[model samples]
Target: MKASIASLTALLVTSITALRPVFRPRAAAAGPFLTQVDNETWVIGNELWNVTQGRTYGVKLYYKDHDCVGDAVGHYVSYNGAASNLNWTSASIVTEGTIDGSSYIDVKFTATEGDMHWIILSGLAGAYQYFVNHNLPTLGEFRTLWRLDNTTFPNGKTDVRDEALPPLSEYISTLKVQDETWLKPDGSGYITKYDFSSWIRTQTYYGVYGENFGSWYINAGKDYYNGNHLKQELMVHRESATGDAVQLNMIHGTHFQVSATDVFPDGKMWGPWLWYLNDGSKEDAELRAKHEFASWPYAWFEDEAYQTRGSVKGQLVLSDGRPATNAAVFLGDSSPNKTALDQGSDYYYTGYADEQGNFEFKDVRVGTYGLQAWSNGSKIADVTTSFLQNNVKVEKDHLTDLASLEWQVSAKTKLFQVGDFDRYSYGFQYGGSPYEHGVVDKCPADLTFTVGSSRTEDWCMGQSKLGNWTIAFDVPKAAAQCSSSKKNATLLVSLAGYSTGVSSNVYANDVLLGNLTSGGGIGTNYTATLLNDPSLYRSGTAAGEWRYFEFPFDAAVLRPGAANEVRFQVTRNSTWHGFMWDSIVLEW
Candidate 1:
């Protein structure tokens, strides 16, 4: 086992904070959405809906990661009220279904049209360590738009407006980051306006930065169209010192407004959606209160101009021609934008194949795009004409249907392979040292799959370790041993040729089971357990004592059933000779 692979990762997010106080009703980290299979594995999901302007939407509620797999569950709440009345009503996530080969859940809301409803999505899964580089976008869409189109100014300036507003009206094309937060307050060029004579002229502006947030305004709110002038720079401050050096053009958009009136809930005044997704943290609150994370509140990505020309539909299949449900599919245009295209592009659009392997891309601009599929981080093989060989064309006025796309990818690691999180989601822990060593076709093991390309022998010996290596299993709830009334369970460990000066201890439900420095026959490389194994037919001079040690654990440290967590570990503080583990057994 590589020491690099044994490090622990922060597995869940806890809270949320929106742009303002009113955006407060938006849910934040509502406790970690996770379920542990064992101490070794678990899954997480989150809500990520991209509502279009027509309210017709497509969404990827949870982004997949290396280890997590499952579909996101959503609910339509407030049964008693009308559509408009229930738009902001709060609700809980009712259920979730697993997607075949994908890591996260997906939903395309076009089929559920006419329902203008509010939603609360579960969260996504991953080992999120650095907030600064984590792909989860805090402020995806930072832009400006004119609320009302084709308006005349009191000065008789017809269409005397900013050309910059057009880009903001569309989704993702003109998206900008709040990286360089503060605006040049030196009356810098604010040129996207036209003087009354229909003659375009440049204006000047200045801005200020707030804690975790900031903004820029046209200098003096210049006289034009009765203060309806849409010359502003929308910005969003990042939670960390710096966001990704390259930002993603990924958030499915709903509002691409360069002006205030364009926001939904038309009757409102002043600010855009002033929401705060309460993630139960002051720092998170302060961060969210400072900037707009895209068109969050009006997240519906739509406009009459955005139609078939910007949309696409397709299907997916496995190598065997069956529906490849839940495979992660990505579309991107190296020319328009780059994304995780692995194709060297930075802009991209993401979604997953549904139960039938069907998929769609909403709110796309007219351009050429390439498609890619992935399952648990490994790229799936495309058996058909190479999607990478030719870029698919997404023209205006029509939906590009590629018929059916095929993907081929599968898990390779064996279930019994030590530290394998994908299979036995067990409580496996390691520290101090990492190594692998064991007799082939000798020791009894539980893993059913083969290790690597060839199997030299049948049983797992362990990884070969030189410096130091450790392995511990947190007995899962299902195979718990201390459940009966007698409650006393003894864990027997088999080892061969281990380093000297080894110490042992066990933990149940996180409670320590008192340390035990001595076991059955120490000093010799072999413990009592190893000597008793009938399978150990030493072919050559035996390396170590090849012994076994038994540690009796009392009921006080172990939980009967509810808190069924059994942890055991062994460590060699000083370097001498490394070791090999044959098997472990629990006797009541």
Candidate 2:
């Protein structure tokens, strides 16, 4: 019996090995011969090559020793083929080799006939290590080195080289570590404005860095009219003199004056622009960039044209007569009757209130503008109210002191609320880790959340097309109030992200309330959820902006002194149709 069992096991093992595809290893290269196409993508023999179906092709990836550290044992090749429904398949084997005194990772895989075929080489430094150069603006951790087409290559081999980058000193002359306070927003204890401006000008006069330095420019000239020209520069450095990897970005532009009668004409401002420096992750670097961008037209500018700019100051009070502390206030162009909530293409200025609700916009361009303010629900209780004051005038070298702007809440009595109003869905389940895809697939099929008993994890961050989500809650005095008088119920929904062209049908106790259509599509949640590396789609907090809406329904639909269910169902049948809620409040 033992002999027979061993024979059967041997037969099964032989059958599985026979089914596996075999790949031949390529010989070591004599020298580096790969041609560069772009920063990330590269080619082998020629700029273009035709791929033959069912033919095995060899791939070699060369990298510097310091850039990545690991043997090529774990390195493998993968391809996304259109013929295979654009599915990603891994190569059977990987091997280590050397070329011209440099280390190279090698793999072999069969090609398929497809309209779009992307060959991906990865696993250079093992899991969670330095897979690709972080300085470049490449997508995700893995690099897509080649794209297969109907072109032929010599010996059916694909090879690419990663050249050593020059030091940061080569780009900026007299490089010195900036004071830590210069990176702060308050500018307290920082160097003098004149000294900082002089340092910035010296860096700008230096010619643009090379492609190997990961430098790019943004032309703000086309966006803002009225003869306003602004040029921005962004660069990623591998390491500084202190051996710390730092990402540096700077924006410097000339400012012009706008008449008070004009609507601020978007983008007209004055200042010596600021620069951001960080040694954090890519997401942290982006956040720093956003802060520097918003803090434009620095009040300390010594420019002659900027000396005559005025300031706007005011206080914000909520409907409950409480100071709206830490609220975000903005002065935007009033030409098209647009407010801060509109998020128009016109340029806008942003500021925040202090603990006493006193907010001020410094160095405001002499012009007429619209003032808007909204609380992020940090200091005060969450309320679905916004303050807007139009026809605000700011004169040259004058302080425009406006009256206290009061925010009026829509609903009076709030029965219950789900999630916080911080303008993000990070409080709910599957919200913090947005890098994963197929989040909806991993969620419960029928999510019937009980208000008091269910925790935040019970509520998914986004609604899926698979089915409707039900919220169950008990309102004790609902029946008694209905007997005396008919009170309307208001549903306030604050969305952190959403898909456009999709509508959600809301119901109370099986009765129709209203069909809510999403405003704009600012996120790729639907498409990103389908990919293996969903982290590639993540843009941190820049993924989407918060949008607020109110839905009024008949109070009779909600059961009194009993279990009440609010159902939300998407009208569209698509994986991409969804909404990420920041908060949902039921008010009477």
Candidate 3:
């Protein structure tokens, strides 16, 4: 009996110890341009930038406990991929007053060139470390780099580069360009949302090795604004593979390239700094080109070219077979674009039906998106953002059919989960925000569902861990006019456990849904949901096997017009049994 007791205690201890995650701390709120991650380094803004001429540089930084009340001294370091070799040099700091009404450090520094520069903010106890690159000359045009909530690595390394998802699979497809509507400048309008497929032609070019080792490929379907404030479609056929980078290049003029005087010896040097699309992925692509491929590769751009466009079109027939004109069709998805940037706005794309009940989405990007349509009598019909579900799958070089879109709004609608699809599989996107992710650092297996199974592996993660795990997707818009637009929306999580009960406080947009308990004895043997409570289980039916834990909410729980966030706060009480999260899905 004594030996048996010791063995039991040891098993419990091992299970408890197996669940902690090891990674950088995540921040809350919109990240400032600078975050003093540790006393040693800061995550500097590394957006599409190139310093035209070296001069006095300054930025507002987020520091703890104190504002910029005084000046301090610090050091700057340059990095080589070589972990052991680093060039550390001393630098000076001067304080500028807090801008606006926030507590931040405004540090001013003088530098000649910028190459992923790293610095430590001087302080008494834990002096803060920060990173900034003065390489981009246009200080006023600089966009904030690394979301304030993203990770700040040890050196001035980029979070995206360190964690970026693998390059999108290469694909060849056609881009579809729909019609343009000519409307008056005034409020009252008159025009057409017609399908003019292939109005725009695309060309592809891939460069092999040259004398300068400048091998590159331009696989983008190109276009410019036909008119100011013009909206059109750039469509691609959906690929057999899921989300991928859609390479797009929109240049201003004849200027082929530009440079960073901050990094070059003389002002006469030039580079591809300005030629590429101006967004957050510039320097990241540079680093990837240098290290990963040893050459610059194309990237996915989140935003459509300023005047570029794409559309989802189809006639909605009413119950009586009449055209449902003026009905609203929405395209929503939170999956990352090929460029892997989440601009938030990319989550919702909207279009309206013409008098013929023909609806078209004017501008959309590449990725898997969700769809919802609403008419007069009823509203909020759930649909997948795919070719089969009347949802538009926008790929490059292909045009989404203007007549392929269709939906029927109802009084109360539903969504049934299709388990075999990877659209529901998620660890986290490559180079996604650092705060949310698969527990790859601690539990390697918790990143995704087991092959052909809907539940997580029992040993995946958390013997006794606390915190939140969340997944987000574009929310299908509930009916705007009617109160009974959508009903019976529930989040399903399949879990299994042994000795202990691992539970989480389920939340949809911070509103409490219910407690999801795993590994605990259910009041009844199983649950009855519209979608099968199971996807194919690999384990047994006891406490060690998978059981359904659902978080049911009202139709109103769907947010107004953007991504719907589903978060799980692991607030478990230790019985020291085994527990794991298998599958999570939204079924209405």
Candidate 4:
């Protein structure tokens, strides 16, 4: 039988001692919403809905019946107890009754619409998959009730059918390590006046270094018309132990804000909606309080108009197409009041948009401002100034390209042996003899070797003269073991003894290997050389025995593929006690 390959050995070990997979609910990083042709039918949860605001988009909610008693005709009262056809906002107007005995409530707004960018529809009492469509919006007489009743749905409870409702993960997935997180404010954090005035302003941050940075305010209280309004800033903070990083360890919990765009009980506030959304609903308050991470309640995005430029505007999004919430927007260039556009200077201020992904630049000069939005420590989106037409002289408008950015996920490393938690007590010590072999004395009785989950007490070899102990195991020719992605691969090798610090030197066909160099103290290297084979293989402790001594070479020269021989070489210098090694896998 042929000796098993190194990659095969790694695979077998991993398989035999399979670790339970951790099911972490991550945000559904997806592609952004590409702008379809105007009025095209975009499908959300499989129910096709018409896009009304030209190509600019907004979500909608419809109801065909208010009460269970309605039977296709006759007038009925709405939840608000309104008589039926009372005009409210631009889109919320009660019109004639539908065959299902329900009045029509149209919701119309676009990403580019004025301050009113989004709407929420919460509190659908016992609503199931089947709902009635009373009418569709257009610019005609604006009065019609076309009922599409009893639309059967197979996965209504499990799938999200509304365009306004973000994915469950989006609402719950906290900013993970290396993932970007944009900061914004909850209106309740700051004190202010005016129920809905464009008068909110100011944002201040106290860095870890005791430095407080403040940015100019853009949109005022008027912009935060509904949902709990407050001045806020969208800052991007990285996650780290020493620096100012915003980490999503999941242990800290995800932070989000409730938006007016979400459906809520009537007469409720609107802002950014946040809470643990395990599957679909919010997380339990009692349990969440203990495990969930709370938003930085004191930090508020200013609700005051800090400044403004010549009609400059834009939007922001993540690389994965999700809206980059609460990012700070800034302008780079500006023009003197009524002066030539080219001769303008740059003015800068910051402001964040509401839940629909909007923002404003205050005190902005009239020329061209490099439109940049930042969240946490990362840039959300950046665009150049636009000067389209006369009426649109202020090139600032809806930014559609943001919906195309996507975040990339990186791969993680494998080897991890360097005494993970400082629990193992041992180190390298000096002995009187140089070539007479070192020694390891006084090993603790509780010493144990653990790989994956299998534990064993098979450690052999005495302590080094320096003091630290060691362990080694021969590759069982009868066993199939090892793994790797490389092709035309070869000899497998695994052994743990005393290293200068942490790691082993690997050799292949005596060519001097070149892989696994930076693999920390714990490393791996495989080969396809002879000496380690089957049918004509040599066994027992012979030439290859001394060929692989404990403390053979330095870690600086080890490589992966070209590695033929594996050995443990300890350093004679340093007062750093000693080190231990165990459980290695190698094959041919």
Clash number for model 4? Answer: 111
- Cα lDDT of all candidates, in order? 0.29, 0.41, 0.30, 0.22
The prediction achieving the highest TM-score against the true structure is 2
lDDT of 4 by residue, 1-588 (tens): 012222222222111112221111112111111112123322111011111112211122112211111111211112111122212123221112221332222122222111121111122111111111122111101111111111111011101111111112222223321122111133121111100011112311111101111111111112112111121111112212212111010100001111112122221212221211111222222233232123321122122222222354555544445565554443332332221111111123345644545654432323333443333212322211112112212332332222222323112122222111111111212111111111233333222233333233333322223222222222222221232332232222221212222222334323333222112433333321111100001000000110111112232232343322333333232211123322232222
- lDDT of model number 4: 0.22
What would you estimate as the lDDT of candidate 2?
0.41
Best by lDDT: 2
User: Judged by lDDT relative to the true structure, which candidate is superior, 1 or 3?
Assistant: 3
Question: What is the C-alpha lDDT profile of model 2 across 1-588, one tens digit per residue?
Answer: 235223322322111122222111123222212222222222221111111112222222222211110111111222221111211123222333342343333322222311112221222111000111112221111111121111111011001111222332333323321311121233222211111111111122111122222111111111121111111111222332332222222221111011111222222331222211112123443454354345444332233544556889999888778898887677776644422333323345666788878999776667788887776557764756777788888889899998687788654666777776655566577764522223443455457888898886777777746468888899887444744474678777777655443456777788776665544322321211210111111211111335566667777777778989888766564343356667788887
Q: Name the runs in model 2 displaced over 4 angstroms.
A: 1-307, 335-346, 432-445, 501-503, 517-545
Off by over 4 Å in 1: 1-309, 334-346, 377-389, 408-588
For 1-588, candidate 1 gives per-residue lDDT tens digits of: 112112111323323223110001123333223322222222222332111111111111222111000111111211111122112211122222332222222221111111221222334221111001112122212222111111110011112222112122222213321222221233332111111111111222111122222122221111111111111111121112212111111111211111112111221111122222222233443444343233222223222322224667888766656665555566653332322211211224556767777888765646677675543111221211112313777787678888876555322211122221111111222210111111222222223322233232332343222222222233345545424455566554444334333344444455554432333434432233211211111111122223335556664554433424344344432222223443444445
Q: Can you write out model 3's per-residue Cα lDDT over 1-588, one digit (the tens) per residue?
A: 235223322322111112221112123222122332223232332111111111211212223311111111111222211121122222223332222343223333333433322221112111122223434232111111111111111111121112222212322122111112222234233121111111111222211111111112222222211100011111111111332111111111100011101121122111112112111333433543344232211132111332244455566665435565555554554332311111122234545566766766544545455554443211212222112143447765455764534444232333323221111212222111121111222433122222223333322333235655555555434532243554667666554222234555667778777654544422422322211111111111111222445566775777645666676566654322223433355755
How does candidate 3 fare on TM-score? 0.23
Give the worst 10-residue stretch by lDDT in candidate 4. 533-542
